[model samples]
Target: MKKQNIVIGVAPTKRSFLSMEEAKRQKEKFMAVIRGIHPDVVTLVDIDDICENGILFETEKITQVVEKFRRAKIDALFTPHCDFGEEQCAAGVAAAMKVPTLVWGARDERPNTDESRGRDTQCGMFACTKVMRRFGVQYSYIWNCETESEDFRNGFDSFIRVVSVIKAVKNLRIAKFGARPEPFMSVTANEGDLATKLGVTVVPISPNTVAARMDQLIGENSPRLQDYVADVKQRMDASGMKEEAVERAAAAKLAIQDLMEEKHCAAGAMECWSAVTVLGAPVCMALGELSDEGLPVSCETDVNGAVTMAMLQAVTLGKEACFLADLTIRHPQNDNAELLWHCGPFPYSLKDSSSVARLVQGQERFELKKGPITVCRFDDVDGKYYLFGGEGKGVDGPETNGTYVWFETNNWKMWEEKLMFGPYIHHVGGIYGNYKKVLREAARYLGMIFDDADEQGVYSL
Candidate 1:
């Protein structure tokens, strides 16, 4: 995983009621905290000259700082108030940088009769925020005035998460194979709108092209195919599966891999059902393998689902894989739980080891790993994109063939209502963790409507 690059700026001013020595001390402390949080910090402007105002208040100085940040390709900016910060300078840097910005300050010292007593950074932060608003700059901030407090660390972490999502979305390119299956209009996406509004590009490839590639690989007796087959046999109970089915699935996986490499795509969505007619096996297991290997692939040509999966991958830095599943049926024993099942597209690593193993064709029958999971979807209504998600736990459930998980949310009825009445589909992406907060922050930064289903109720951002 690539580390997110961050640039730290300390805003100090001569007009601050505090002495130069106090400002320099606070600046060093802020730099220490920033250094502990991230490694790739860019000190765009020198803070050593405390005798002069350290803040870049002049337009020329702010422009020079912006140029430095742009050249370094920083992902986000952190502005800390050394003293009463230069509001104009902070806002100027934020507006010009055009990246996720965070503003914060140290707590004020108790006033004394001495001239060097007051820092008044809390007041400066407020003024800086107002100027940022006037300049139409969006930013995040630590509400607490203390720079070394736990609250500040948490807020800083959240800001990093937000930056990861923004960077991923801005640079994403989805490989779309074939089209949405017949009778599944819910998965249809406006590619033009996706590109124009969200900076997401879709590279279309035909199912026939993939099939042709698979046949060529088989004819050439590719070593990759042999390795993939060996891998499948090693990882799965393939005694029940047909030999031809196994070969076809492995060939399809290779073909998809080839196309992904050729197109330089980050994520993919495939026509799984249609490919079954051509490849002699469902592509679910192939997709699962790809997702497990760090590239998320969605079934039924779910473009938005692939995008959502990509977002999850970016936020988690591939530490977890997102499972693409349909909200199939309600759990028989648990009224508040629903069954999330797919043909066999869940990663093998997520399958329960104790479940009766059956690898028939490209489909594997097993229960998903039991733990906390988050269910989410990215969709649009009237050209406006939205992200919806909530937390749930993966619990023990009855097996009904294929990859399955019993997810119990706080309120199934409310979830159903949201899906039914909202611009969402039955297809959703699930990742193991409580990442609703991360997703919500990403949605806010991306300017997308976020519908969060929590215990209290559904709320929008």
Candidate 2:
């Protein structure tokens, strides 16, 4: 997870009847709020310096402020109107910086009187937006007037999460091993489109290369391989699995880890089923371990799934591990709930408290913990990429086999309809949290279609 550095530009105007003192005071309050939420804020131009009676009225001051933001490596920009804002100044700064930008203003005081109330920040925001458009600058805005209110806070927080996703995807590199399983054609991705539009680079690794790495590790009895084998034994009760299977699984884990480090890759997607037969063991537990360690590995060589997992990891700042599963079955007891299951690749930390995750037949199997979860996918329709998500909760269900979770949504039928008719497949990424809003907002910021579900119904943009 990368820390975001934001630059805040305060806009005010001498033309407004609002006093300079009041404008300066409001600017300080807005700055304080931002500082509380994000400590790394670059306010290069001080309120006092920008405002004699207005903010950044002079071109020379705007240039200086832009230079400061450039030098600071600012990730995003925010301009809050303290009074009737200087629209040109705000637009000028945003155009110069050319980053994700936001514009907002304080609500007007009630009972407007000629002497007591004169700040028309609402009107100023409109003008600011127009100028930004004329300059061909893309930005976001808080529609509400109350900057101190909860609505504004929510918007700001969502913006930060959106920025985090953008930053994570901009320079992302994924290690793709082999091809997607021959039968599962739905998991295919457009590698060229991903690189052209999202700045993602896929490093293709041959199956023979991986096999050679695994053989070398086993033949040399590498220290890291030995340590990983011992650690696996200490962490998992692998008595049910064959001794040879355990060793094979350990070798597969070392091979993947070594390749990831060698390639300087952030995430990976592997042809798990074929690799299982070749290695004489399943790769589920090994992939799960990598996900737990903040390096997400998707099954079936689903490159897009790996990208979605990486986005979720960044959204959570790597504090939580994400699971990749097939929307396998509908719950037997509840029509509104469905089963999210994989062939035993979920992290051990996500296993339900009632059941311990165990290595059986070379795979770890357990029910997921009951809690709020966010289900999402990054998929494309005819090469146009989109993000789809919904919020649900893990519930109790009958355990069949493999890693599973009983996920219940408010409108399960609607969700199912969307999945069937929309540009998505059976595979989805699951993480513990109600991050539907965050994902939706992020999709909007990234200019991708967001298909989201909530209490009201399913909606898409």
Candidate 3:
């Protein structure tokens, strides 16, 4: 997971209106709240001891404080709600940092008193919004309602969104096992381009080196691999797959440890199709286990998919997730439906497969029979909002293209109608939930086209 340093910005209230003690207490309380959500250093701008209520919003004061926050390298800025006039200061600091800004406001609920406080607080938030608009900056908002009120749900939601924003700004490290052979255009990516645009560093390693490291796991010398293989086998046993597939899966599991260390990768994309298959080893099963273990593997050395999956893993904190999908037109009766198929080796736990393991005519050949799965991913169009979608649970269609994993969600509509740009893939896998916005922001920072603007238009994949 990517960790980031967050800087909380605060300014002293004007003394004529707020006593020094009261101002300190208010600032402290707000800072405490922020720390509870994300513990970090708080930078007090110390603009003034106290000001006339409107003075905090003064252009000069705002500019000075904003400059200080920028120098601090704040990932996100949180400040108390203020009148519309005072909002530009916060917006200016956010613009300077080019980071997401959120307004922290207390939502009182004491009947008449509550209404007044809420209105005042919301006004401050609206003021910041206007400043952001004026500067053409993007921002988010969070409100902390009275503890007793039911508004805690929304409060938590906003806070999580802030967390997502932070994750995106922080650079993610992606490991590439090796370059793909020619003819796989969809998967090749320019690492220099990725670093220049998204802040991601592509850690590359030779496939030959990974192979040499795996050899070390063959004997009784590698205790760590032995232990990991045993533990992985235990998990596979609990999965109830056949004995052969399970044992092969275990070996593959051990191999991942060898590869990650040898490659020095936080996440990996593998090309085991030729090597393992020719050697009569279960490469697909191992890749699936590696993905299930949180080191996502995009098959056929798909670099973009590796980056996309890594972004999702960072956002989801390495929970159950995979990118199992394909893009094709749905049938007339299934316009709302899209097929979720896997050409990679998937564990039996991900889907139910038949005992008869054989090569499908069109799909990639595999040793273990594939099964059903949940499918989800983000679809992006540059300079536009992204679409998040999923088709949950279903059997394979009777076609050489492989299995069908069904999913449906209104989240697609939300992406189309709401957020700008998102993460998506022509290839999909099953594991965790969609980190739609997280991937989008990462792509924005990397400056890569998340998806072709004319994807649905004339173009060859």
TM-score list, all predictions:
0.89, 0.89, 0.64
CA RMSD for every model?
Answer: 3.6, 3.5, 7.5
Model 2 spans with C-alpha error above 4 angstroms: 1-18, 38-57, 145-147, 454-461
Across 1-461, the per-residue lDDT of candidate 1 in tens digits comes to: 23333344444443344466776677777666665664442234443443254554345566666666676666777777776667877788788877777887777767545654576777778888899989888888777457678887767766666777787788888999988889899899988998998899999998888889988988888898988888888888888777767888888888988898799887899999876787666788888888877778899999999998888776664556778899899999999999999988888777776775567767877788888898889999897888888999998777788889999998888888777777899888988877888888889888898887663344333
On the 0 to 100 scale, the lDDT of residue 170 in model 2 is 79
User: Would you give me the overall lDDT of model 2?
Assistant: 0.78
What does candidate 3's lDDT look like per residue over 200-262, in tens digits?
Answer: 577776666655545555544567765755665543332344544444445555666556756
What lDDT score goes with residue 141 in model 1? 78
Model 3: CA > 4 A from native? 1-74, 82-85, 104-119, 133-137, 142-170, 181-183, 237-252, 258-264, 277-280, 326-335, 343-404, 409-425, 429-461
How far off is residue 330 in model 3, in Å?
A: 6.6
How do all the candidates rank in terms of TM-score, highest first? 1, 2, 3
lDDT-best of 1 and 3: 1
Q: Residue 38 deviation, candidate 2, in Å? A: 5.2
